[model samples]
Target: MTQPNIVIPPAEQQTSVEAGDLLNSSTAGVIVERTAQVRNGFHAEGRKFARMMAEFVNVKQVGVASVFVYEETFGIKDKLHWLIHLSSLEAYEAMVHMGTSDQEYRGNVSSEQVSQDKGGGGWDKIFVDGSMQETVLMPQFWGMYGTKVDGEREKQTSVYQQQGPLTGLPGAREQVPLPVEQLVHSGNCGLLLHRTAQLEYDFRSEGRTFAREAAESINENLPGEATVFVYEEAFGAADRIHWLIHMKSLTTYYKVLALHVKDERIRDLYFQERIAPERGGGTWARMFVPGSMVDVALTPHHWGMYAT
Candidate 1:
């Protein structure tokens, strides 16, 4: 990211004031400070809420001083304070009328003619007054478990510069595979994982029966023990599935089959049956009821499959 340009005007051309002048003058200025604890989340006791502080300024002849606070995070703007204007009753009324008629007014105050530059220049002795504090809370969670299929383990080892064979071919150098463990852990629900020999199947019908029929067809035809995972749309699940299958005779290695369905409910039902219950220790391979693999064997052209 490019750094923001910080333009500092010449000292001679800038205006300066003391805290006393700011409280007494009928002009506008801003009060800025560094804060380590800003409110975050819906509840108190949340993690670090640090923020840079800025207060909009509106000065008046009266003793009332109104300060509005604002904070920006992740490129989003949020209002943290209210419109405060310190002025006499008459002055307040006039400011309001001016604000209502003037097109250039940017301050949130209801009045016009009140100076809007939070002191336009800068001020000294901007002492800290009593603070208003609030507690903030943030929540997080995790789930799921699986082993990295052999090929992925090999690839990860190669990238990490671990001592390993340069290639998987036999009669060549036997590289040491990296030591990486596959385990179940808590995480978001929609992440996708890519694995070998499995193809994504897209169905075009609008009902659960159609999906079940398709699944049965694919399950029956593929080599026994071949792993298959079905997803309605790419990235629909937080963590995607990894399939393992053998296909030495086929030219294309991994097939991503697209199943187009007109009914959303049918697609959802299919997904739920195929991928939702791994948490209970039931194996995905076993989830394929008999006859699930029959569709792929019959309608090779009606479905679209891509190899990765």
Candidate 2:
């Protein structure tokens, strides 16, 4: 599909997904990275502000995701990792562009680009300026699966679950997945696990095979438990692949991690078998967005709740 080229005006306060939307675009989803310590009042406020802009500004609603990663290796609860999904890079830039406009920009667009345009950076008092750590994600090949049939029960625990349907993107509704509710259940909370590794060989040839093997493991053993995503680092610490796991329940979330830690064949493929080696730097985290954060969960028209 030819992605529409969209250039939103700064301060326009209206959303537009001229380029392909993120939920299912093969080449979309710019991992919006921000260095944030979990539960800081200002930082959390900044995230919510940006999300509000995306909800109100664009021609179509785009999601502002807060994906938190929990890695036992770090044992640092003070630092929190998160991902806010904008429709595209342009959409992100435009959202931040509001910072340079007439009104003060309260949202933390990226850690680096906080504006002095309004009161010489005083806005950080309410919302700290943080930089967007860059990353390379796998092309959107890992998608929602195990869909709930049309008349079956729907499971959605997203902050945006109550938000309207997705629009301006393929696979948002028609293909890829269906009614956002099916992607996850309502009572559940979400957790994201991002693991970055340095490849010893080309994953396209070798790593992919291992990934497939791992996927098969999930399907066979931990069925309907989690959604797995592998991302190649495009910006942060060079040469890294981030593996993201989105889970619905705390029960399944912990189970999958325990499974990975003990499983030998899966461990051999990456660790013992020598495919991708640790770069001595990576994080595994379980991100949970408060169900009360309805403002943060507001998503775009084309957004999907889950695969099933």
Summed backbone clashes in each candidate are 56, 41
- Candidates in order, TM-scores: namely 0.16, 0.46
Q: Which stretches of candidate 1 lie over 4 Å from their true place?
A: 1-17, 24-66, 70-79, 106-308
> Per-residue lDDT tens digits of candidate 1, residues 192-261?
1212122222211112223224433333333221222222212223222222121211221232132224
Q: Model 1's lDDT to the true fold?
A: 0.24
**Model 2 per-residue lDDT at 228:** 50
Local distance difference test values of all predictions, in order:
0.24, 0.36
Candidate 1 lDDT at 267 equals 48
